[model samples]
Target: MSARSNRQIVLKSRPLGIPRAEHFEIRAAPVPALQPGQFLVQNLFLSVDPAMRGWVNAAANYSEPVGLGEVMRAFAAGRVIASRHPEYPEGALVMGMLGWQEYAVSDGQAIRRRVTETDLPLSLSLGVLGLNGVTAYFALQELGEPRPGETVAVSTAAGAVGSIAGQLARLRGCRTVGIAGGADKCALCLSEFGYDAAIDYRQPDLPDALRQSCPDGIDVYFDNTAGLISDAVLPQINRHARIIVCGTASVASWDPWPQGPRVERHLLNKAARMAGFLIWDYEHRYEEAIAHLAPLVRSGELRFREEILDGLEAAPGSIADLYEGTNLGKRLIRLADR
Candidate 1:
């Protein structure tokens, strides 16, 4: 085997609400010999996204369920160790849905980005420069439509998507407020990401704190948490405000749906518009977004943090950890020996 073989994290069962270790199985597998039109990729980075929780359950929203006994699905970046296809040569790096494994055989159909000029980091393809970044960028431009001098707020403020969203809003000259779970994340939001203000959702009263943070009413609410944390801010929206419904982190447990404040009166009072977005729906403009974001990242205006586990055997539990807010920014697993 070109890379470490005999390793995988398989789905033991579909999760109920918060996932447990019993939902996953780590196993050994022999690396099959490569043949014509086939390519063997040595996994380098595996992503653990919160969306994986919904994917592990019954089909809801937009994404499909993760079939039983399948290698837990994920986006990953890796190097080609053995290739039999004309275009996919050995030693080339590619990014795709490589699943939770140290090694995988592909027909080259899943290959997304063929690592060429970009020498940033292979792990980034699974995190900031990849799906998370695109999702954040799209939700802001399409849903929030932030304007200069406006006040913008984001939930999940220190997370992968939220971090980028705050920076983008700030870049547009918006007064940005971030709502994260803890003081540490709130500090990171304000100090590291330069958000104008940040509120710890763990506080006793979220709405009161949000009121103090945004004294001038929220102009654009980039919501990542859709329960009480979101409801707390709804009553304070500005007239003609835009509410970008990015993700509902509070409902990540996949359990009995959470109960939040009824905000119909607040919407009537503010006349705000709330819109939900799906990342894949913006695929046609993906490159356009990267074109806009890449230079900003290169110019040091944007930063990314990743909490990476060392092997594929940790993929399943790492995914469960994501929903618990254990990951600082982007959660990833490194399959290659670094």
Candidate 2:
């Protein structure tokens, strides 16, 4: 293969809230030569996630903010086209922080894992077989500890992680209720993802809808949106209910820390437990989760969705679109074919 220039979407300016296309700029640069123990990756699929909102914000998140003029930080799946590294040899597929560029040079430190499931689409490594899937697996099982016949309520139930989490809960014999933005997504939650009940949070009577769906009260709540959705769910927790804090997609900024109904009293009354979940915390157990989820995906026992946008041009505004719920499923920008 011949060498070529790399195209990257770099952060042009920091945004106060949701980042738009104007905040980024596309630039061409010569692909860096591989150094000792380094490899060159031709990224095929770039991920667009809600967590990206925090990555571009001025506020410090779990990881450092993407610096100005740098390629936008993201998880991508790709093939190693050139290599000096023995482990990540040429032709090996990899997934990790490869950013929003067509080509990435890595020393393997930022590479999360090798794409071992060759039978699955390489794109799945960026979604269900990657961080999102592992996150849903660990957070729900370890933190929520849901029991059979219990009621499991999931916010953003039509999204990447929530959809998987809801399905996992259902497979465990728990009754699953999904909370989504629109009626279409709510319907998807029921028909596609197998949620027993679906609630449109955009409706005026969210609390009423939640109450009706979770008649026995919520035994476990997988919270992806932490604003109004959580407000309605918290008050309905059953005795010893478990709450998993996954993502804060609804709230754009946490600068002043958006205020809402206090949850101390609710937890005290119900003897409930709420814990935050970050996928990085469970990095060591990623393969374990993948081992369990892969077979289910292959057998069609587990279902997943993907919305692909062609070319790097889609990279700039994709994150904003994610927050607006424009995509039906896990969103990815296709830069090349695997």
Candidate 3:
């Protein structure tokens, strides 16, 4: 086999709000040959996400910052090229924190066992079948706990996690309201994702729009865009409401973290509970999520949407689109050339 080659994107700068190409550098890398229990992988699909921004910052968070000159961090699907370990064969496909690259090196432990079926499409493994899928599942089920006849609202309802949350909320017999940016996204939430109503926040009087869409009172808010949108739902919260803080898309812009709407009063008045979760906290239950979600997905009772870009070079821009809410669903980059 020819020696491994890589095209890796490294972080050039800490972004202000929206990331630009200047913030990244695409570099050609020579992969080291395999050693005992170590292997080389040709990446097939790259996962781009909003959380990547936080991963780059030196400030405090759940995970350490991606070093300034390192390959920008990411989760990806790749196929093994050369494996010295008996456990990892020469051609197995897998998923891990492989970053934005055409190739990755792994000791079988760094990356784990992979499923080889291409029938499901290798790309889906990085999204609906990967961390994104698990995040949506755990956050919704563990945090939201929707009750029958209650109202469940979600921001970014057309995106990866938000879309799934909406469907699960519906399964619980709740009135689902989706808050998305444009009218098109709003329409997709209702028509494609089965949301009962979609409020286009781009319209003036967004709080009023939310009110009209969720007239029954908000019982559970699966908040993906927590800022003003979360504020809008607070007053409408029923007695003993629940808020699952998933993402803060509304303040995705960089610089100083934007001030959020004052919600203490509402929290006090309603006795509602708001909880933020780190999806990895439930990593132990990842297989459980896949076992359950895969059936729903394959059966068509669930919908999967991916905004796939053409190549690794497009990875940084794809993540920028996620924070801007420009992409329709899960924003991802295809690492394979096919």
Candidate that would win on lDDT: 2
lDDT of 2 at 90: 94
Poorly placed runs, candidate 3 (over 4 Å): 116-118, 253-257
* Residue range 1-338, candidate 3, lDDT tens digits: 34556789999888766566788999887887667777777888888877877787666467997888899888888887788877778778888888888888887655633754466877777777777778888888888888889899988888888888889888878889998889889889988999999998778898888778878789999888777777778889888988999887777554575786687888888998889989878977778878877778788888888888887778766666677667887877876653
Give per-candidate clash totals: 0, 0, 2
How high is each candidate's TM-score?
0.93, 0.98, 0.94
Please give, for residues 210-273, the per-residue lDDT of candidate 2 as tens digits: 9999989999999999999999999899999999999998898888889999999999999999
Q: List model 1 lDDT by residue over 84-128, tens digit each.
A: 888989889888888888788999777667755355777777766
Q: Which pairs of residues have clashing backbones in candidate 3?
A: 16-254, 17-254
lDDT of 3 at 8: 93
Candidate 2, which ten residues in sequence have the lowest lDDT sum?
1-10
**CA shift of 317, model 2, Å:** 0.8
Q: Report the CA-based lDDT of candidate 2 relative to the real structure.
A: 0.94
lDDT of 3: 0.80
User: lDDT (0-100) at residue 11 of candidate 3?
Assistant: 90
Instruction: Show the colliding residue pairs in model 1.
Output: none
